[model samples]
Target: MYAILGEDKSDVATLKVILKRLIGDDSIKIKTKGYNGCAELLRKGAKQITAFSKLGLAIFVVCYDSDGKDPAKRYSDVVSKIIKPTGLKNTICVVIPVQELEAWILADIQSVTNVFSSWKPKEINNPESIDNPKEYLEKLSRDCNRRPRYNHATHNEKIAPYLDLDKLKCKCPSFLPLVTLAENHDAHVAK
Candidate 1:
């Protein structure tokens, strides 16, 4: 079994879809848990990892948003604060989405348009560089006069399943960790 941890419900929800797509195996059981937010995740992650490990879940995928902070700092913090302390660094995959998880959402404009046909979002050249990607998406939805605007908590899950994994991997460098994790896990399972 594998496990996934993230800062919020939206992150967990969206990540679940992304992982399933990348792994291409619905039969693979993936357990997931979401903390309140970044602060809560950071404060409680180590304990959670230990609990999941005890439960026999070997591989862990932890998702954290950079939230305008340096991506390297975010990655290091997860490694130091969670993985290292738990002595499970090798089994843990840390995915720090630059700025916010919304950046990945923006990586595939076609997916967004497919979900919200009325809002034709412009292709973002550097989605990872956006300081507040969620706000950018919300503003774009409002600007296009799309009804029921973009709410990360709901729309993220909806758009995620349809996203082109190739596009996301190419556009968001931080997203590669999850791809690698999925690939490694798939190979292990195949063996």
Candidate 2:
């Protein structure tokens, strides 16, 4: 069994799709837990990790948005503040999405188009580089005159199933941890 932890419901909701696609199996028993937000995740993450570890969860995929902070530094913080203290660093994958979780959605323009046909995203060569991808997505939805402009909480999970995993991995560097975790799990299962 594997568990995923994210800053909010939307993140874990979207990740459930992504990780299932990566693993290519519906019976793997992937569970998700979400915190209120980044601050809450940071403050309470360690305890959650420790508790989950004690429960014998095989792996934990923890996600936090960088929120325009340095991705590497945020990754280090999650490692130090959450995983390291649990002494289960090997069982945890820390994914710090650059700027926000929406960046991963923006990485696949086709996915956005699949969700909203009217949404014509301006060429986003590097999604992770966008200053505020969540706001940018909302602007795109609004400019296209879509009813109920892109909301992170709703649209992220909506678009995730349509996302091209290859495109996301190529465009969003910080997304690697989740991919690595999936790959490692696959290897372990194969053996």
Whose TM-score is greatest here?
A: 1
Expressed as tens digits, the lDDT of each residue in 1-191 for candidate 2 is: 68888889889988988988888876788778899988888888888877776777768888988898887888888887787777764467788888988888778866777777766666567888888888988877777788667788888888988888898889888888888888888665654
- Candidate 2 lands at a TM-score of 0.91
User: Any idea what lDDT model 1 has?
Assistant: 0.85
Query: Residue-wise lDDT of candidate 1 within 75-174, one digit each (tens)?
Result: 9999889888897644788999989999998788668877888777667778887779899888888887888788888899999888888888899999
Query: How high is each candidate's TM-score?
Result: 0.93, 0.91
Worst 10 residues of 2 by lDDT: 182-191
C-alpha RMSD for every candidate: 1.6, 1.9
Q: After superposition, how far is residue 179 of candidate 2 from its true place, in Å?
A: 1.3
How many residue pairs of model 1 clash at the backbone? 0
Best by lDDT: 1
Candidate 2 wrongly placed segments (more than 4 Å): none
